[model samples]
Each structure stands twice: as C-alpha cells, then as structure tokens.
Target chain A: MNHRIGWLIAGLVLALAGASQFLLNDYYQRVLSVIAINIILAVSLNLTNGISGDFSLGHAAFMAIGAYTSAVLTLPVRMKAIVLPDLPVWLGQLEVPFVFALVLGALLAALIAALVGTPVLRLRGHYLSVATLGLMVIVQVVALNWQPVTRGARGINGLPPFTTPLWAYGAMLLTVGIIWRVVHSPLGRAMIAVREDELGAACRGVRVFRTRLAAFIIGAAFASIAGGLWAHLITAITPASFSFLLTFNVVAMVVIGGMGSISGSVAGAVLLTLLPELLRRVETSLALGGQPLYGLSQVVIALLMLGVMIFRPGGLFGREELPAVLARFQRRRSAQRQAPHPSPSS
Target chain B: MFTPTYLAQQLINALNLGSLYALVAIGLTMVYGILRLINFAHGDMMTLGAYLALAGISALVLPAWAALVLPMLVIALVGVLIERLAYRPLRGAPEVAMLITSLAVSSLIQNGATMLLTAQPRPLRVPSALTQRIAFGDLSIAVMDLGIIALAAVLMVALGVFVKRTTIGIAMRACSENLRAAQLMGVDVNRVIVVAFAISAGLAGAAGVLWSSKFGLVDPFMGFVPGLKAFVAAVIGGIGSIPGAMLGGYLLGFAEVFFVAFAPPELSGYRDAFVFALLLIVLLVRPAGLLGRGEVNRA
Candidate 1:
C-alpha cells in the first residue's frame, strides 16, 4: 500500500508485459493487450459511474473521439490522403508518434468532455443518463455523416499495430494509478459525498459540481486513451466499433467487479475479457439442429449479469479492494483460530 | 414546396408516425410512472411483439387481424412474467442495480432472439387491403396508415377511460402518485403493477406490429431505435404522465418529419442526432417536461 510497494508492483507488471512479448504467442499477446485496454476503460469509467456515481452512458463517444483523433494523426500521410482526401491539409499531412497522438487524442476527448459536461452534469438521474446517451448518438452521427474526415461508414484500416502488451499494460497501470490517487484524495472524498447526497455535500462545503466535472473529465481522458490503444491494437478503426455495445461491455465490467472499487474493475476487466473468449470455444462445439450456436456467449453473460444483480447487487468485491478482502479473510481466520470451540449447549 | 397537397400528405405521415410513437411511449411512461425504473427491455418487447406477430401470420396461418391480437395477448403475459421474475426481487435495491438488471434483461432477450432466429430480417406479410391507398382530392393516404392512427387513438381513449373511470385505473394512478400511501390505503400493489405491465406491453406489441408493417421488416434489434425514440417522447411529454407522453410523441414525430422534409437533403442523415439534441435541450429547459410536476428530492 506504500508508495515504494506501489512502484515495485508497477515495475513487476511492466516487466511481465515485456516478458510476454517474447514468451507469449501472437494471439495470446493480442488478448493480453485487449485485457489491458479493457482494464483502463473499466477503471476510468468506474471513476465517474461508480466512485462518483454520475452514471454516464456516453463513455463510448469519448472513446470514439480519441480513437478517431489518434487514427487520423498517426495514419501514414499517404494513407490519409487516400482515405480522407478532404481532410484539412494540416490534418491530412500531419502524422505524429504513437504516444504523442494518443496523448493528443486524450486531450481532445477531455476538452469535449468539459464542454459537454458543463450543462449535462447539471441534470440528475435518468435525465442525466439520457442526455449523455444523446451526446453519444450525436457523436456517432457526426462520425457517420462526416465522410471526408471519417471516411464515412467504411472506417480506416491497415494502420501499424503500435499497441503491444508493454504499451497497453503500461497505460493501464498509469490509468489505475491516477484513478487510485484521485479516489484517495480529498477531492475524491468530495465526489463520494456528492454522490451520496448532493444537497448535503453542498451544505458540508463540498464543491459538488466541480467534483463531478473533475471526475467526468478525468474519466473521459482515460477512456480516450483506451480508445486510442484499442484502435492501434486492432490496426483498424471504425465508428461502429465504439457503439453502445462497447459501452455496455465496459459498464458490465464495472458492475460485475464492484462499483466504487479499483481492484474490482481490474478483476472485472480480466474476467469479462476472458469469459467470451472461453465461451467462443464452447459455442463452436455446441450445435442445435445442426446449426452452430452463435450468440450463446452473449446470452450466458447477460444471464450471469442478471444473476449477479439478483443475488449480489454489490458485485463481486462490493466496494472492497482485493487486498482489503484478503486482509479481512486473514483477520477472520486468525480470530477463529484463537476462539475456543463451543460444546453443544444443554 | 409548401403546397397544400404536399403539406397534407406530410401531415398524414406525421400523424401515422406520431401514433406509433405514442403507442410505444405510453407503455414506457406507464411503467416508469409506477416503478420509477426505466425498463431498458421495453424496446426488445416491441421486437418480440413484431416477431410473434410475424409467427402468428406466417407460421400459424392466422389472419392479419388475428396475428395482431394474438401477439398483443402473448406479449402482455410476457411482460407480467418479466415483472414477476426479474423485477420483483429487486424491489428495494438501488436504482442503479435495477437499471443494470433491465440492461441485462434487454441483452438477454436480444441475444436469445438472435440465437434462435438467426438475426436476419424477416418480412411481415400484410394483407393487401391495408396497403391500399385512399385519395382525397390532392392528397392520398394508405389504409394501413389510417388504420394505425384510428387503432392508436381508440387504444389511448380506452386507456384514458380505464385509468380515470375504472377502480383498477384509479388504483394505478394512486400507486403512481405515492405507492406507499396507495398500499396503506389497501390497494393491491401487485395487481396494479401486473396490470400496468400488461397494458404497457400490449400497447408496445400493437405498436411493434404497426412499426414493422410500416417498415416492412422484422429483426431482433429492430425495436431498439423506436423504443429509444419512444422513451424520448415519454420524456418530452413529461415522464409518468400518460397524456404528456402522447403529446410528446406527436411533437417528436412532427419534429422529425418536418426536419427531414424541410432540411437540405445532405442533412437528412443527422435526423436521429437532431432528435437527441432536442431531448437534451428539453431536459435542460424543462427537466420536468411539459406536463410533469417538478421532482422534489426528499431528504
């Protein structure tokens, strides 16, 4: 839990990621990258949706902005000219290093979040949710109709796959670290207070609006980074790739892991990412009336989520981190060992 | 460009569209009013209705009228079943948990449909009589459109009478106003909830059939967009108010039709975006909607 231990664990993770590049096969490496990106997305989304309780449904839009920005910026100039002929000359000609493009994309996403969050963060409950969903649809509409810049529905492809396990895992660590810091800071406590009771938080001198806006902007920035990583990992980008389904998947991760828990997000990201992959094999082998059982994984996952909601609505961790849970288990066990066994009462 | 005949034709189109939206939105508002839960699966219910109607006509060889009736009944039951199985247990849980559960239900239904039906678009065969057009001097309208409008109006009027005049309807209104007070007054909360879901799903079923007929296609995911738009309509009218939902639906339908009709052709693709923007604007200016009472946050 100390700073030194945190740095050591981060170093170990990066070293493992570096080792995976050499040890793991291409397919496994790709999966690892996807898992890392999903972790970044889930953790960032949890900052707003879970920790701050803002419940944004437009995370995908920010991701799309990041993806598109990074894709356009890093697309070889020749390819940009061919794919996006009508792009502004400055935009069409410019190409940046992968990290710089990703950063720029994140910044752009953060700027848009600030712009949209100003008015939108004023609303509460379902109204806020629908307003955010509207923002998502508007963003998608632009991406779809702005053919010159986005290449219409065809999307962009054949980009260099700059997202390795190292890059993805490193970014994931950074996102988790930043969010972890934010959640533990005074501002994070303010966010929690606002979430519990906006009026009460205001009465307690917490700047409710600023706290929420901060969470929203920071979450959007990290989501954009995840988007950029996703685009580069796949070496292809499409507007459709950043649709509600992606948001739903991320939301599922946050919910299943435990809302308001950082380690829960990591666990949820890993479990959900691997679940479908494992189910994909099951689906292929299963058949009904000689037809392959496609979409089975989705049905199962949805059912699992429903079951979780019904049985354990707090999710797997229920607002507790992995270490906290383990530590509690250890304490309980020690206490049990010290207690005298009771004989049957008369 | 603004000729009377063209305007009349557009008005008819708007009316037809508005009726469908109102039908869907009414159901959504009814559920939200009583439960305060945004049933994300409502749209999928519409899809299921369409598919059921398709099956009734094509697979069962039922007449078109029979097809519509059967689906409505079946979907009504399905709605009640879902309320009991999925929603009842989470009664006192957090709003977000219920929301997530609805999302899960929606995904389950959509994926289940996809798994069983193969996700392909199926054509819903309509009798030729409904497709025939009637002309009034300069303007012409399809019989199906007329039928849809009349059917929707009758259903709404029936619903109004049921809610205002009937004991159960009054019970529903009581529950929506204050569920705890209604229960304290000896209202059968379960019965009222079941009736609300049945009515909502039945309306959605009818709307689904009409919507699919209008578009001439049925698919697993077809209901999502219309369902979402209907929710917007419900919001615009002021959620939890029936008449408000109807009004909002008509307004949305008219806005959409006119926006496309008047805007440049290149701007047509952004019609959905325009609708959502209108939603955002409405939420900002009148969060309680045109008819909804302002929500008071009780400490």
Candidate 2:
C-alpha cells in the first residue's frame, strides 16, 4: 500500500516484461513488442476518448504523422536519396538519432493535435468524431499524394529496427505513469467532470475547453510515441498501416476494457493482442465441413466484441480500477468485522 | 481549359455518382434524424444488399428482377433486425455507446461477409443492354448511368410522397420531431423507428445493386469508403434534413468530379483530401450546413 512498494512492483513488472523477450522466439518477441505498443496506444486514447469524452477517431492519423516523422528523420542519407530524390537538401543530409527522432515525432504530433483540438474540441460528441475522421482522411490523402516528402503510395522502407521489448515496454510504462498522474491530478478531475457533464463543469468554473484540449494533446503525444515504436519495430512505414482499421482496433481495446480505466486498457490491449494470434492457430488447425475456415479469426473477434458490448457494455472492469477494487474489498472486510453481531438463535 | 463536350461528360459522371450518394445520404439522415445515432453500419447494409443480389442471381439462378427485389426486401428485414438487436438495447445509452455498437455491427457484417465469401472482388452480372453505351456527339454515356439517374429521381419523389402523404410516414416524422411527445400521443414508437430503419435500408439496398452493377464489382469492404462519403454528404447537406442530404450529395459529387477532372494529373490523388477539407470548412463556417437552420436536434 506504500507508494515506494507500488513503484517497486511496477518496476519489477517492467523488468519481467523485458526479460521475457529473451525467452521468446522471434515471433513471440514481435508479438510482445506489438502488445506493449498497443497498450500504449490504448491508454493514451483513453485519456481523451475515455477520460475526457472527446470521441476522436483520428488517433491513427496522429500515429501516421509520428511514424512518418520518425521514419524520415532516422532514415539513412543514401536510402533517402533513393526513396525521396526530391527531398530538401537540409532534410536529406540530416539524420537524427533514433531517440531524438522519436521525441521529435511525438512533439510534432502534439503540435498538430493542439492546432486541430483548438477548433475541433469546440464540437460535441458525434460532430467531433466525424470531424476527427475527416482529419484522418485528410492526413491519409496527404500522405498518399505528397510524393516528395512521403514517397507517396510507394511508402518508406528499409529503416533501422531500433524497437526492443525494453524500449517498447519502457515507453508504455512512461505513458501509463504520465496518464495516471494526469487523471488523478486536479486538472484530470476537471477533465472527468467535463466528461460527466460539460455544462455543469463549465458552470462550476472548470475551464472545460482547456481541460479537453490538454487531454487531447497528451493522448496524441503518447500515441505518437507508440507509432514511432511501431514504425521502427516493423522497419517500414506505409500510409495503409494507419487506416481506420487501426483506429477500430484501439477503440475496441478501450471499449473492451472499461473506457476510462488505465489498468483496464492494459488488460484489454494485452488480451486482445494475444487473442488474434491464438485464433489464427485455431483457424488453421480446425476444419469444419471439410473446409479450412481462413478468415474465421476476424469473424470470431467481431462477434465476440458484439457479445461483450451487448452483455458487458461497461467492459470487464468498468470504471472501478484494479487498486480501487482491492481498496473496496479491504473496506468491506473492515466494515464486516466492526458490525454488530446477529442473534445466535436465528 | 475545359472543353464543352468534356464538361458535359464530367457533368454526367457527377450526376451518376451524385444519385448513389443521395440514396446513401437519405438512409443515413433518416436513421440519424429519428435515432440520433450515426448508423455506421449503413454502408455495410449496402454491401450486404449487393452481396445478396449477387447470391440470388449467380448462386440461386434467380431472374434479374427477382435478384434485385429479393435483396432489397431481405436487407430491409436485416436492417430492422439490426435495429432490434444491436440498437434497441442501447436506446438510452450514451451517444458513444450507440456509436461504438453501430461500428461493431458494421465490422461484424463486413468481417462475416469476408469469412463466408472471400475478400476477392467478384464481378457483378447486369444485363449487357443496361450497360450499353449511348453516344451524344463527343460525349458518350452508359445506359446504366441514365437508368440510375432516372431511378434515383423516381425513388426520391416516391420517398418524398410517402413521407408527406402516408399515415405511417406521418408517425415517423412526428417521432423525429419529438420522440417522447409522439409516444405519449399514441404513436407506436417502436414500430415507427423500425419502419424508418426498414425504409432507409431498403433505399440503401437499391443503391447497392445499382452501384455494384455500374461498377461491376462486389466486395465486402466496398461499402466502407462510400459509407464515409455518404456521411460527408449527409453532414454537408445538414445531418437530419432529407433535402439537405440530396443537395450535399450532389455538391460533393460535382466537387469530386471537377477536382479530379481539372486538377493537375499529379494532384488527382488528393481528390479525397479536397472533399475532407470542404467538410472541415463547412463544419467550421456553417456547422448547420448550407440548407440547415442553426438548430441541431439532440436525443
């Protein structure tokens, strides 16, 4: 229950995650890396979509921006010549270190988010969502057409693979810590208040617009880092990678976990990432009516998600988080111990 | 820089495309007007209709007329079933919950189709006579295009008359106006909502068959882009206004065709970008749309 002990446990979990990569085969290692990146993506999105109630569908657009930024920065000079021959001399000659490139990528994403959020955050609910989706379509179309900067539809390939389990999980922990601190802060409470009742929050003197914008920027920054990690891990970047499907997957993670719960996002991310891989195996091994059910994995996922939405719409943990659940259990036990005794005759 | 004949051809293309967008936008706006939920599954319903037609014709060897009518009827029921199963439970849920549920339903239908029928696009088989080309000076048009335009206009008029003159249609309009009041005033609320969804889906089904036959392809994810574009059309016209949806759809069609036709060859790929930019501009400048009053109806 002590803060130090909690920090120790968190550090230990990160260490274990890092150590497991050594034990895993190449495929499992890749999967673990993906799981960590996805968790980061899910949690960051939860800050805006879950905590602030913004309902943005453009998370992948920011990811795409981040991935492309990091990729362009870290790409080798010679490869840049081949891929983007019309690249500016300054950009073509300059190659930043991977760490700085990742930071720059995230910063750029946050900057864009700030600009977008200023106008977009004013809209409510479905309008905001549609605007964000429009932004995504704009981003994708730009990436598809901006040949000099993005290599257009050809995409960028042959980048260095700098993403490891340690980097991925370490970045995820940093994201989780930042989000946890923000949501628990006074500002975070304001954001949640806005989510609960925007008009009421404004009436109570909460700077509603500012709080929503903060969550959006923070979520965008972390999503950008996840995107950077994903790009580096895959050693290639494409406009196609950051499509609506990516947005859907992250949204699924948020919904399947309690939307506003950080721990729930982690659980949802990890479980959902592993599920499809498991399903793929099952699909290949199992045959029905003498036919190999090739795409059953996605079908099952969609159906299962629907079932969860129908039956457990609040998600597995709902808004009560891991620590909160434990605290409630302790409180209940104490109350039971202090209660007046019942009649023995009864 | 534009030739008269080329301009005329592009205009024809725009009208053809606009008709499809109008059908989709009407469906989207109707459901959104009543339910106040953006039915993301509308596009998937269109895809389902197309696929059903494909099955009826190719697999069951049904007549072409049978293929078209059967799919529209079936998908209308499917739309009602979707409303009953996926949406009815979330009637009072938060906007996000319903939005996400519609998204889930969309993906479920899309992925289920992919699983049952491979993702490979199959060519649709409309009669050659329908697709036959008719020349007008330097501008040639497919009979299919003319048929689609005529069909779309007739359907729109029919829908307008139905909404204005029929008793059930009056109930739907009342429900959309004020749901609780309509319920209190003896409207069969559930039936009205179900009827709205069925009508919307039926229109979407008709659009789907026409779209597939015109394009000569049927695929699971085919509806996704068109669906988003239809949403754009709906938004631009005004979210809940039928006439606004049609106007927006036509504007979008003209914008898309002209942008591609006139822009430099290299910039042609940015056509969608132009559309989205128009959307953002419209959202910022006139959130109510060109035809909409400033009021945005909320559930």
Candidate 3:
C-alpha cells in the first residue's frame, strides 16, 4: 500500500530467490550469478545516465580497475610467495575475505574517479562521451600492456571463484538499495534538478559540478563491486571483455530497462541477458550452421532498441520509479474492479 | 630499415590515415554546423558505403576509377534515405534523442550487414590502375593513397565554397544559427539538414573506399576506429568548423604515426587513447573546440 510495504515485498522476493539459487545446478546457478552482476552494473550506470543526466562510456575503466584490484588483493599470498618470492606478502597474499576485497576494490575505483573526474567532468555531450569512452580504451590498453601488473594481454588468470549466486545476488540487492535510496534523497533530487536544466539549477543554488562528481564516484564504486564479482565468477580476466561493445551492452540495458526506473534496470538486465542465452539455445537445437549465428545478438538488441525508441521513447516503465509505476497501475485496476460501473437493478 | 626511406614511408602512412580521418571529420563538421547533432552513425554509414561498393565491384567489376565516382553516388542516395527516415522523425526532439537514435541506426546497419552478408571480413579487389605505385626519390607511394588526399582536398575546397558562396549553403548556415528566424525567412530547414547528411555521407563513403583500399581489409567493425578518430578530429578541429576538422585530422594522423615511432611497441595500442587524452585537454582549454564558435543560446 505504501513505500514500506512495497520494499518489504521486494526484499522478501529477493531473499526467496537467493535461497532457491542454492538448489540450482552449477550451470543454472552461474547464470543467476551473471544476472546479479549485471543488475549491479545496470543499476549503477543508470545513476549517471538516468539521474545525473550524463552518458559515460568509461564505466568499463572503473569496472576494470575494481576487477583487477580485487583479483590482485584477494589472491593467496603463500601461492604468490612461491611463484614470486621477492614480492611482498601484502601484494601477494591478499587473503582478505571476499566482501572486504569488494569494498577495497570499490574504494580504489572511487579514488580513481576522484582523480579522473577533474578533467573529465568539464565535458558535455559528445566531448564527455568521447572522453569517457577514451578512458575505457585507455584502461583496456593499460591492462593489456601493463604486463607486470595485469599479466599483459594474456590476462590475469586464476582469480578465486568466490562469486556464488548468494554473494552476487546479495551484493545486487544491497547496491540497488543504496542507489535507490540515494536517487530519492535530497542529493539525488539536486542531481535531477541539475539534469533538467543546468542553468536553472545553477540559478537555484545547486552545485551542479559537485553533485555530478558525487554521482559519478558512487556509480563507479558500485560498478567496481560488480566488476569484482564478475572477475571472481569467471576465474579469469581479459581486456577484451571490457571493450566498447561491452559498454554498449550495458548502455542498451539501461536504455531498454527504462533508464530512470530501478525496476526497469533489473527487468532489463534479466531479460536481455537471458534473451541471447535463450536464442543461442534455440539456434543450437535447430542445428543452425554457418558463422555461428554471427550478429544475431546484435540484431535482436538493435531491433529492440529501435522498437523502444520509436514506440516507447520513455522506455518500458518510462521515467517513473518502478514501485510507483507498477503499484499505481495495479491499484487503479483493482479500484476499477471494486467500483465496477453501476449495473441496472437486476 | 631505419633509414630516410623508412621515415618517408611512415610519413606517407600517417598521411594516408590522416587523410581519411580528415575527409570524414570534414563531413561531420558540416552536419554539426548545420545541426548540432554529432551523427554517431556516420561511421557505420561509411561501412555500409564500403559494402555497397563491394557489391558494385563484385557485380560489374567497375574499374577503380569508376568505383571512386560510382560508390559516392549510391551512398549519397542511402544517406538521403537515412535522413528521411531516422533523423526526420527526431528533428524537434532533444539532442540526446537524436544522438541515441544515430547509435540505434548504427547498430541496425552493422547487424543488418551481418544478416545480409556474412560478418567475415572481405577483400575488395580494385582495378590495376589504382594499386600502382610511383617512385618518389627515396620513397615509393601507392597511387590510391595519393588519390585519396587529392580527392579529399578538392572536396574540402568544394564544400568550403558551397558553404560560403552558394545561396543554399547560406540558407543552411542561417538555419543552423537560428532555426526559428530562418524558418520565418522561408528556409526549408528539413531539406537543408537532409542535404547536409547526404553530402556528409557521400564524403564518408569516398573515405570508406580509400580506407578499405589502403588497409586491404573491410569488415563490419572497420568503421569503429576510424569513426572514433574522425570524431576526435572533429573535436580537435572544433566540431562545428570545417577547416578545424581538416586541421585536426592531419594533426591526429601525424601524431599517431610519431607516437608509434617513439613509444614502445606495447603502448602503440593507445594511439586512440592519446588522441582522446588530447581531446580531453583541448576541451578543458577550449570547450567550444579550436574552430567552434562561442555558445549562443537560442532565444
């Protein structure tokens, strides 16, 4: 009936879902973990694209930073001591627990945000997009070339696979809750005001630059956590995985899931991630041959984008908050039923 | 290999790459000047143009000379169709919508290429006249590379004259400055924008052909790098300024070659990253770009 009740319901559903994940086979459980990881990424990115009203292509840079940092920190020191005996135990034996590693990763990513945001925050539109995109490219390039640190283009393999469905989904819920709270907070409202019209917001005493930076840092931190989970889940990391195409996929999810809606972000992350997997299965079953069904995924994504842009420019749930959109619509339908038009005395 | 001849070869390499970027950036500036949209799909359109040209070469075995002329015509028409469909609907929407729409269109085209033709890279064969190289003292050069620079230069001058000396170009310029006032004076804003995309795309197609010719490979993803480089060039040159894009393209080309020459091999993949960093620096120093006009808010 109210926000409290709605949130309670969402929490219950998530808890039940997390419990059920343990019952799943490794393959199906991994899929759930993937979905959870994407949920964090999609929702965090939305804070910038949807709320801060900035389109950042460089999120992968933050994701990479988090993933690599966590992988390096969480790996066993005794193992590295044997392999590279000269290196310090601190660098090698990151024997911290998984959650601590995630937080450390997020902190390091946020520090990077503070450093880069100075120059990057100045740009708007294409300039900003290009700069952020450049950041991503630069990160990938560094990851590939920074051989001593990143193991070069061969990628940093042997990451601990601690990313169970429980951890992944729990992090998603926690991260989403934090972001959703921020989105409705005073700071979030200020960010929205700035987005609606920077000049007007400035006139009204909004610190546009500061608010934007705050949003950027927070979003980066959350994305970092997601990236850490992803690195652990796969047990390997590659620069190629964080390419522009990957950024585009995240952006498409945000756009498709109704950019401004938290529920839409979850829906989008789940649906698009599953859609391709489903399609691949079907194609496999049908024994489709030739080029491995090249570009089918992109085509589906493109068509869906076209349809959403043309027919539902506001996205599936529009700019409306999810709880508001779904709950309000349901309430209206129920109200209509209860008040069903006066039947003539029968 | 590290002799004068080697230096000359690298210079030529840079020039060829830079020339294609300049041509595409020049087209980008025209559309940006006329309508502030960055035309994200411009690069993908170049990919489509290359594909179209490949079809031409495969079907009729057009001489390289004929291809240089023919692909431009076909791509110009395709460009006009893109304007009519995707851009026309969003003329009055926010800049973000148009930008996003261009991205959508680009994805559609890229995937459509995959669906229509195999996603595999193909070698487009050209006539013998185009591939022939001439000896220039210590350095030899591909005729196609020289042709690309020459054609791009000629088109630049032609475009400059069109924007400055022609009534339609003047109308287009006027509309870009103040759409409402230009409409009051009877400028067909829609037609001018459509024309801008068409001409911009035509130049992009010609550049695409040269790009494919020089690289010896063409694929769906080929457009991504060049498109981004040209966008960098546009930003470097000043997004809304034609001469600015040309200058930026040359500088970018020269910079990439020299950066590769000086930097360690491992850092070479960062050529674009270097340009992007410059873009960031340039934006910080001059947000409007080197050639761009000061921000003028619409009344």
Candidate 4:
C-alpha cells in the first residue's frame, strides 16, 4: 500500500479507538486516556533516549513543569486566590483557555529544556543520567517547596477534566505521526547516526551536539505536552504525579517496545499500562501462603523489564515498525508457499 | 544559634552522614569505574541488606552484630547473582540499556520488598550501646556515630591497601584502567567484574546498616534519596577515583548539613534543591570531578 493509504488506515483506526471510549466503562475509559498519555510520553522520550542516544532520567521533571504551568494557568482566578494567596499578581489574575495553557506550558517546558540542554547536553552516558536525575529531584523538591506557585505539594485541585478520550487520543495520534515523520526526516537520520556512532557522525560533518540538543529540546516539549494532557485528565496536579517512577515506566515502555520504533513504543505503552490493571485484578484473586499479593504488578513489571533487557536487548520490535513486522511475516509466508518443499531446517 | 557547640555538633553530624555516604559512593564508583554503568539498583541492594538485617533481628531472632554481618554477606551474594544474571549478558549492549536494566532491577527489588512488607516505615530496635550518647568536652555524640566514622575510616584504609597490594584488587584497578589490556594480561575479566560487584555491594550493605541504624527506620524505598546523594558524592569526588568518592561523600555531607544549619530557616526545605544545583554547577565547571582523571567522551 502507498504511504498515504497506510496513514489513512492508521488514522481511521485511531479514530475508531477514540470513538470506542463510549463502549467502555468509566474505569476502562480512564485507562484508555492514560494509555494515550503514556504513548505521548514514551514516543517523546524515544526521541532523546532511543534515537539520539541520550540516557536521561528527567523526562518527568519536564512533565511536572508543564503540568504545573497548565494547572496554574487554567485554574479559576477565584480558586487560585484561595489556594495560592501568594501567587504573583499577574499570574493570580490570569486564567486562559485549556488549549492556550497547554501550549504555554509546553513552551515553558521546552524553554527550560533548551536552557538545561545548553549546559547539560554536554555530559554523556551515566554522568548525563545522574545529572538529569538530579534535575528531576530538584524539580520535585521545588514543586514540593514552592508554595507560592505549586502550593507546596497540596497541588492544584478542581481542575476541569478537559482531557476527554477524543483529546487524549488525538494528541497521541499527533505525537506518533509527527515523531514518525521526524524519524524519517534528514535531521532524524542525523540523530540516528549520532546514536549509532557519535564520533563517526561528527567525523561525517554531522553536528553532534546540535543534533542531540535539538532532540532533547523537542523530546522535552512533547513530554510537557503529555504532562498537560495528564493534568487535565486527572483534574488534579501534584508534584508526586511526575516522579521518577513515571519516568521509569516510560523508559520501560521505550525499552520493551523497541526503543527506536514509534510503533514499538506505542505497543510498550499500551501493554505496560494494561498489564498493571490486569495484575491488580489478579493480585486480589491470587494468594501466596494465604496472604493476598500486594505490589505484584510492580514486581512483575520490573521482572518483565529485566527479562526484556537480558533476553531481547533490542526489544520485542527491535528497530522494526509495525508495518515492517507485518511485511516480514508476509514475506516469510510467501517464501514458504513458493518453495516446492520446505527444508527441514526451514 | 551558630554557637561553637552547635557548629561542632553539626560538624559531627556531617561526618556521621559523610561516613555512610563515603561507603555508598565508593561502592558506586567502583562499579562505574569498571563497568561504566551506574547501577541504579546499588541503592536498592542497600535496602535489601537493611531489610535482611531487619528480618534477621525480628524473624530469625539473631543478635545485633550477627544480624549486621549476615546481611552484608547475603547482599554480597545477591550482588554477585545480579552481575552474573542481569548485567553479564548485556556486556556488549548499549549503555542506555544497561542503565534501564539497573533501574528495573532496583524497582524489582524495592517492589518485592513492598509486596512482602508494605511501605510502612518500620522503626528498628538496636542494641543500646549503638545509640547511647557519649560526652566529649562540650560535645555529646552517639556511640553509633563514632563507631560508624571509625568503621568507615578502617574500611577505607583497608580498601586502599587491598587495591594497592592484593592481586585481585590490582586486577580490578587494571580492568578499570583498560579492559582489553587487562584481558590481554590474562586477567579474568568476568571474575574481576563479579568481584567488583561483590565488594561494592558489600560496602553498600555495610553502609545500609549504618544508615538505617542512624535513621532508626527501614522501608522499601529508603535507598532512593541516599542513593542519589551517594551518586552526587561519587560525581563530585571523581566517578572513577576511590579516594575521590570518599572525599566527595564527605563534602556532600558537610554541604547538605551546613546548608540546613546556616541557610535561612524558610529555605531549609530547598536544601535538596541546593544539593542538586551544586551537582549541576560541578558538572558544568568540573565534569572530571575533584580528583578524577578527565572527562571521557561519553558521547
């Protein structure tokens, strides 16, 4: 099929999935929205982590920034007066539409990313990882302590649930489509080259630092966007919501789905999100030594991640997308059918 | 009050915290020095060691000293197992994969602990000698604090000697210097790696006991903040330098304590924020750390 046709089918599928929310119970619908948000997170992270080859543990920090920005921006002025009596006069009086707040929040996160990336993008490997982890902790501490802005961990409440299934799924589709296009673009190829071999990419006249910085900034922006969606979906925002655990979950999705592939990230996000709920149900039903299992889902997630890392380091999809996987399967089937007789080894 | 006695007390507290940080940082640095992967689970191993000790005291009804030593051994074994099972196969994989795996293993252990024993922070009952205060001139100090400091000093010295004298320790140093050259010299690379993990985890286990004893509590997720601080210490000291890790740990301990001690009362809550900001400053200014050789081309 042509690229246009392929994209049309994917778009149709996403629309149907969004529409199917009406068929689901409230709990399932909520779960679906969460899945969509998670997809945004995983795909955005993949830009820096999988494609650009940076190991960051601070994606959630950016999410926190976005969530707070969106929350503070959209919260009713009267409500803000009660919760954040100390907020700046300008910020206190202002209340924008959710879309504008989301965009501004995302922009603020991207701006922070650019500033942070300028200095932080230089460190490599574990150093970069720790630095980003430090960044995340700093953001968390700020959110917990910055009473004037974030209400010192009481968090903003009574947020309107603007993240309906349509909005969430729509954002997810947009993120995936854009990122997919970027990955196939020249700049994305440059990023992949850097991921493959930074020194070689630099030798070939690819601006290693610039490419990485761009990826980091773009990734951070999208993560912030996801964070905004999440804030609206939950109708509340807290610093705790964007902790390292969330970052870890996103990392798990990227790694398990095949880090560099958009489709793989989507699969990982969906599977990981659904797996916990399924396990939560199982936990109540199953008993170990006459005691109900608690935190079984978390243990299982960790073990699954470890298993994936050890056994399938490239992830389930590796570098292949969904279309590629399907095409490969079809080729194998066709090859078998064309053969007069299948070889024993085959 | 910034009186002399108060300052002295803060100094002692800093040193006490620094001792544990040093131990944890050294372990973290050793692993990073050899494998170049930050074992995010190192902190969790510390948690496991503390939990084991807790389990021994309560369930197995072991004596305090016995409880302390047993957990270290168990954690060391666990560390070796982790090296062989989780990390070994990923030797040739990208660094990012290794990092994620470490995180997975960390969460796996922490979540398992939570499942077994819920997230409630349990107060530990220690032998009175460890917690008893001893008067020293104008300063009154816990025997546990002094003991921890002395123990850390002794361990550091012993580690220095071992790395300088023992064949295996030397092999570890050599491997950290150049893995391929060490292999060419007939150094058993895998054995060195395993021993690195074992020794590191053992130190982390010891630090875990010291930390929990100092704090008087144990929980599933206790290792995270301390682990991050230890990483900060490691980074500040020079990631690959053993002495650097120790120095960084003490510096961090002092900085953290003193920042709280001296900073405006309203800003005490931002102490962690300041600590991270310090890390960022250090990374930007001196990426090689205080005594580290030079910044590697991590890209």
Show how many residue pairs clash in every candidate, following the order shown. Answer: 0, 0, 2, 0
User: Candidate 1, residues A53-149: lDDT per residue as tens digits?
Assistant: 8887778998899898888899999888777889999998898999998899899988988877776677666555666667787888889999888
* Model 1 C-alpha lDDT per residue in residues B1-299, reported as the tens digit of each score: 88999998889889999999999999999998888888788888889999998888788898888988888999999999999989999988878777788878888888898888888899987988889999999788999999999999999999999999999999999999989999999999999999999999999989998999888999988887788889899989989999999999999999999898989999999999999888877766776788987672322
Candidate 2's residue-wise lDDT over A202-269, tens digit each?
A: 99999888999899888888888999999999988888888877887888888888889988898889
Q: Provide candidate 2's TM-score on chain A.
A: 0.91
Candidate 4 chain A weakest lDDT stretch, 10 residues: A119-128
Off by over 4 Å in 4: A10-14, A289-291, A340-346
lDDT of 3 at B60: 81
lDDT of 3 by residue, B1-299 (tens): 47888888888888877888998998787887776777778888678778777877878887776777788888888888988877777777767766777777887787777755767899988777878999989688988878877887888888889989998888878976777899899998888887888888898998888788777677887787688779889888777777888888998898888899778887787776787777767766776677777562211
Candidate order, lDDT descending: 1, 4, 2, 3
Number of the top TM-score candidate = 1
The alpha-carbon lDDT assigned to residue A107 of candidate 1 equals 96
* Candidate 3 lDDT over residue span A1-346, tens digit each: 6768757866885786678666778888888888888899989988888888877666788889889888777877765565434445467645788889889999998887776676667555545566777778778878877665677677777777898887887888888889989998999999899788888987889888788888888999998999899999998898887876667778788889987787888888998889888887654454345435556777788778867776777777777876678688897777778778634531
lDDT of 4 by residue, A196-273 (tens): 988899899999888998898888888988988898888888878777688888999999999888888999999999
TM-score of chain B alone in model 3: 0.93
Isolated chain A TM-score, each model: 0.95, 0.91, 0.90, 0.94
Write model 4 residue lDDT over B90-184, tens digit each, in one string. 98877777788899998898888888887789987778878889898889999988888998999899999999999999999999888899999
Which clashing pairs does model 2 show? none
Report the CAPRI category for model 3: acceptable
In candidate 4, the residue pairs with backbone N, CA or C atoms under 3 Å apart (3 or more residues apart, or in different chains) clash, namely none
How much is A277 displaced in model 1, in angstroms?
0.5
